[model samples]
Target: MPPVSSPGLLDGTGALRTSVEERAARVRFRRAMALMVMTLLAPGSAQLVAGNRRVGLVAFCLWLGLLVTGFVALVVALVVALVHREWIFSMVSNPSLLLVLRLGLIAAAVGWAALFMDAWRIGQPLSLRLTHRRAVVGVNGFLCLSVMGTLLFGAHVVGVARDGILTMFGSDEVVGAHDGRFNVLLLGGDSGEGRWGLRPDSLTVASIDAETGRTVLIGLPRNMSSFPFRDGSPMAEEFPDGFDCDGCYLNGVSTWAQDHEELFPGSEDPGVEATIAAVEGITDLEINYWAMVNLEGFKDLVDAVGGVTLNVRQPIPVGLPHEAHFHYIDAGVRKLDGHDTLWYARAREGSDDYSRMARQKCVMNAMLQQVSPQVVVRNFEKIAQASTAMVSTNLPASELDTFMDLALKARGQKVSTLSLVPPMIQTADPDIPLVHRKVEQAIEQAEGGGTKAAGGTGRKPKATPDAVTGGSIGSLSEGYAANQAEDLGAAC
Candidate 1:
C-alpha cells in the first residue's frame, strides 16, 4: 500500500486539530482587537473589564473629566461668539488661560498614551496563535507609539507656551487699542556668547487697524537721532530737548537707559521703555506692545518651516570671509533654509545698513506671504520650539490670540511698508514731525486701498513683484529698496 497521504501527521485527525486551533485563534484575535478598539474609544475600559480595577477607574475618571471640560469650553465659546464676539476674544487673550490650556493638552497627551499601552497589556497577545499574536503585538505597538509620539509633541508645545509666557512677558495686563489701531514695536538684536547684550539693529512699528486687518510696517533707522518722547515719560524728562544727548542714536537709547538705570526708578524695563518713547515720539502713535528677537535664534524658526522661498536680488554672504568661511548666498528666486534665511535678513558685508533694512522688509514680506498655514502645521513642533528660544516680548500671552486673529485677516490683505531711511528724512538728524506725517500717510494709504511700493528716495529694485518678493526692497540704485512702497512686492 502507498504511504498514507494525509494533511496531518496523525492521518486526517491532525487536520481536524489544526482547524480547531485556527478557529480558537480567530476568536482570540477578535477579542484582542475588540479590547484595543474599546480602549481607543473609551480609554481604561479594557483594564476595568480585566486587570487592576483601581487604576482603570482613575484613568477613566480623568478621561471623562477631560471630555466634560472640552464640552463645556466648546459650549461657552459658541455662546460667547454669538452674544458678544469681543468677550470671546478677551477670553482667548488671557495669558493665564492660555497657559492652563497648554498644560492641559500635554497632560491629556501623556495620560492617553499610557492608557493605550495599558490596554495593550490587558490584551494578552501571548495567548493568541503564533500569527495572531504577532499581529496583535504589532497593532498594539503601533497604537502606543503613535499616541505617545503625538501627545509628547503636544506636551512640547505646551512647554513652549509656558516658556514664552515666563521669559517673554512682563505684565499680563492688556493695553486697549488707540485710535482704532494697535501699534507694536518690533526690535531685532543678538546676545550670543561674544555679544554683551541686545543691540537692536532693525526697528519697525506694526500698526494694525482693529476692525480691518490693514497693517503698516513703519521702519525706523537705527542711526536716527533727535526724536522727542511721550510727554512726562521718564526718558523725556531725562532728555527734555529730545533724545539729543551726546552721541545718542535710535538704537543707542536702550544702551543709554541701561547705563543710567537710576533715572528709571523702579521701572521694569527701562531700556525698552526709553526705546518705546523714542518710537512713539517719531511715529506719533502710542506703543501698545513691544517684541524683541535674538536674531541668531531666528534661523531655527526658519528651518522649522522647512524653509522659505524668496527672490534673492543680490549676492548675500553667509559669513565673513576673513574671519571664517565666506559663502555667498547666490542671488535669484531660491528656497532658503534657516541659516540662509537668517543671513538674508542680516547680511551686510558690502551693503549699507539702509539697504539691509529694505532687504529685511522683503524677508518679512516673504515670510508672511510664503509661510502658509499648511506649512506651519506640518512643522508645528519645530516652529514652536524655535519661537520660544528666539522671541522675548512684553505682550502678554493672552493677547496673542487676538493678534493671531488679526494676522489671519491681514494675511489676505497687502502689507504696506514705510522705512525712515536716508534722502527722505535725514537719519542722522531726522525731522520728527515730518516722520509722523509720513507714517500717517502710509497708514491712510493702506487703509484706503494700498500704498505705492515703498518708493520716493528708495525706489525699490526693478523686479517683477509677482508674489515671491512682494515687490523689491530695491537695490542700491533704487534708493534703499523698501524705504517706502505702496506695494512691497511691486517695489522689490
Candidate 2:
C-alpha cells in the first residue's frame, strides 16, 4: 500500500473525530436515561421508610414526561440541523425554546433536591427516627407553604371566567404626576328593598398616595343631609316610589328627583352627581373614582377571604324582625363571616356607626392578618372567585397590575385608622365639621398632604374660610340649643 498522503491523513482524522463525537453523544444519552430510571425506582434521598409509591410514581411520571418532551424536541432540532446543514438556524431556534427547556430543567432539579432532602433524613440512624420524622414533617409543610405563596400572589391578577357584573371604566392610561394622590368616593346606600340587587351600605373615602403608599379611609355617615347632589335636585327624590320611610333614611340617591312622581316613578333613582359633589366637598379632594358595593357584596368579600377577624368589645345583634338574624360578634377576638361583617358594620344602634366604623377597621385588619402564605395558597381558587363578584372599582384592568404591585409592596406597612366622631367633630355638628375646611384640612394632613404635616400632629390650623363655614358650626357665638340646631343641621 502507498504511504498515506497528507490529504488522506486529514480526511481520516476528520472521520475519526466525527465518530468520537457520535459515540460520546450516545454515552451521554444512555447515562441520562439510566439516571432517570434510577431516580424513579430507588429511594434516592427520599424516605422509602414512609413512601406512598403510587403518589411518588405519578409525580415521577409527570416529571419524566416533561423531561422527555424537552429532550425529544432538542434531538429533533439537532437532527434537522445536521440533515439540512443549517447549524446556524438550529442554534438560533434553540434559544427561542430556552424558557420551556429551562423550566423542565428546573423541575428536574427541584425533584432531585426533594429526593435528596428526604434521603438525608432517611439515611439517618434508627435512633434519629423521632427527630427525622419531625424534620420530614417540616419539609412537607414547607412544600405546601411554597405552593400557597405562589397562588395568593397570582390571585390578584387572575380573574375567573364567570360573568361578574362587567363594570367597565376608562382604559388605564398612566399620566405620571408627582405625589400622585387619588380620591375614591365610596358610597354606602341603605336600600330598604330586601334582596334588591346592590346598594352601598357604608360610605368611605379612601385617599391613596401613590408615591408614599399611604392610605386613609374616611367614613361618611349615610344619614348626612346637607350634601345636596350638585345637580340641584330635591333630597326626597329618592323616595318617589312611595317607600315607607317610618324610620329608614331615604337612600342618598333618591334626593335628585325632589320626590316628584313624574320624574322617577316606582323605583328610587340614584343621585350620582349629587353623591359625587357631596363626597368631593367633604374631602376637598377631587374624586377620581367611585365604587359601590352593597351589603351582600361586602358579605361575599368577607366570606371569600374566608371570613375576617374582629375584636369585639361587645355583642352586636342586627336585623329587624323579618330579616336574617345575625350576631356581629361577642367580646374579645372573634371571626366574623361576610353577613356578620356587614351587620357588624351596620350596627348603628349598637354603637351608632362610630363604633361600627371601629368594627369595620377591625374587620379590615383581621382580613389582612388572615392572608397568610398558607391561607393564600389553600384558598387561591376562592380568593380569585370572590374578587370577581364582590367588588367593583373604576380601576381599569391595565392599571390593576401596577396598583396590585404597589399594594403588595405596601402590604406590611403601617396603616393608621381614624374616625372623625364626637370630640373630633362636635357633639352638636358632626355633619357641619365634616364638610368644614377644618375637617378637610385634618383629612388632608392625615393623608400626608396640604399644609398639615404627615400624620398631622401639632400642625398650625389653616384658617378655614369663614365663607365655607356658612354659620354651620352652630354659630360659635350661640350657646347649647343653637349649637344643637347647628349640630342637627350639620349632621343632617
Candidate 3:
C-alpha cells in the first residue's frame, strides 16, 4: 500500500508466501522424523499421539503386558532361587508352560513387527524430502527387523527348553529322599522301537549324598542272579526269597514283571518297579528315582555335546570286524563324534562284556570330567534335542535345581566309581553282605570330605582337564581316580 503495489514480481508478496509454506513443510518433515524415533523406542507412542487410536491402544497394551510379565518372571526367579530353588526349577521345567511361552513369544514377535511397520506407514515418508524420506524408510525397516529377530530367537530358546524338559523329565511327584541321599537308578537299555520292548542290558546306581553332593556310582552286572527285593515291596511279596528262578538274571526282572503285570496292581510302572527292586536288593541302596538312557540313542546326545573327549586304551572296532568301513579308534586321547563314541562305549570286539563295562565307565568319567557349563551353553539346542530323544526319567522337575547344584559341587570334587563286575563282586553269585559293605565303604569315603556346599564350604579348585584326561585307559583301574581316592588326580 505504501509503495503502490507493483505487479506480481514487483509486489514481492508471492515470494514471501512461498518461503513461509516451505518452512512449514520442513517443520513437518522434522516432526515426522522425531515421531519415527519415538516409535522405535516405544512402539505404540507414535501412533497414540498422531495416528489410529485403536491400533495404538492395542499395541501399547501388549507392550505393557510384556513389560509386566518380564518383570514378574525376573522377580519370581530371584525370590525362588533364594527361598526355595526347587520351585524355581520345577516352574521353569514345566513342559506345558514352556510350550505356551514359546507360542506366545512367536506371536508377540510377529505382532510387534507388524505394529512397527504400521508406524512407518503413519510417518508418511512420501511427504518428506527425498533424502529424509529414504533415511526414515531405512531406519524403520532396520528397527522392525531388530525387534522381530530378537523375539524369534527367544522363541527358539523356549522351544529348546520345552524339549529339554519333555525329553529328560517326567511327572514324578517329589518324594522325600531315602536315608539322607538320593539314589537314582540308571538303567542302560536298547530302547529303540521294536527292540523287544526295552531290553535293559546295563544297570548303574548313582547314589548322591543330599547334604554334601558326594556321589558313589554302584554298577550292577546285568547277569547278576539271586537278588532279593526291598522288604514289603510288591516284588518282594512276589518273589519271597529272591529273584531265584532258574535262568532269571537281574536283567530279566523288567521282562518278567511286564509278563505278569497283574502282580504289581499298585504299580503303574511295573517294569521300573521290578528293576528297582532288583537294584535295591543288589546295591542295598533304596532307589529314590530312576532314569533310562537308550544306548543307541546315546550317540545323538554325544554329538549334541559336540562329541566327548576320551582316552582310548585300545582300538575299538566300529562295525562287525569284517564289514566294509569297519575300523577302529586307535588308542589315544581323541575327541570322538557320535558314531565313534558309541563304538567306544559299546564295542565288544577283542573285549569281554566285563571289559566293555570298564571301558564304558571310562567314557562316563570322560564325559563328566570334560563337559563344562561353557560347553553346555554353547551347544544347548543340540543337547536339548538329543537328550529328549534319548532319555526318560522318573526324576521330578522340582528336584532338577537341587541336582544341578549338586552337579556343580561334584565337578569341583572327585567322583568315585565302583563296578560290581569281575575281580570285585561276583555277578553270578554276589555275596550280598559283602556287596553292601562295598557300597557303604564308597559312600563313607565320599562323605568323609564333609564339605556341604549349602554351608558355604570351600571346595578344592577344579583340576585342568588336559592334565587329567589323556592317558592309557588301563594305566589306572579307575579312569579318573588312580586306584581310589577322594581327589582323583592327586591320587593318580
Please name the candidate that would achieve the greatest lDDT relative to the true structure: 1
Q: Candidate 1 on 1-492: residue-level lDDT in tens?
A: 757755434664444435556677788789888888777887888888887889888978888988898899899889877856656766644556767777776677777777777777777777877888888878877887787677776767656656655666656789989988999999997766854234687899988998877888899989888888888788888878888777889898888888889988897778888899888888899999988877888888888888888878767888887756668878788899888888887887767777778778877877887777688778766877788788878887667667776776787877878888766788778878778777877877877843443533224445444322312344444455466776666544
Instruction: Tell me the lDDT of candidate 2.
Output: 0.47
Could you report the Cα RMSD, in angstroms, for every candidate shown? 5.0, 18.1, 6.9
In candidate 1, position 353 carries an lDDT of: 77
Candidate 1: which stretches are off by over 4 Å?
1-9, 12-34, 41-142, 194-197, 449-478
TM-scores for all candidates?
A: 0.81, 0.50, 0.78
Model 1 Cα shift for residue 490 (angstroms): 1.8
| Candidate 3 Cα outliers beyond 4 Å, as residue runs | 1-37, 52-91, 95-100, 125-142, 163-168, 449-492
Candidate 2 per-residue lDDT, tens place, 1-492, comes to: 655644223454455334554565555444333333344455241332344466456666665675688699788877875654234333332322333444544554466556544443333333333544455445544543454344443432332311232333332544342337666666654434553223345667665677555555555655444333322333325433222344333233335333343643443333444455555544456677666555555676677667876655556676764666633356556777878777766665533444455455545545554566466657655665565545555654435434443444345554443344433443223444344555455445545465743323222112243311221111222211111111111121
lDDT at 143, model 1 = 80
Model 2 worst lDDT run, 10 consecutive residues: 480-489
Predicted structure 3: lDDT: 0.72
- The stretch of ten residues in a row with the least summed lDDT in candidate 3 is 454-463
Model 1 is weakest, by summed lDDT over 10 consecutive residues, at 465-474
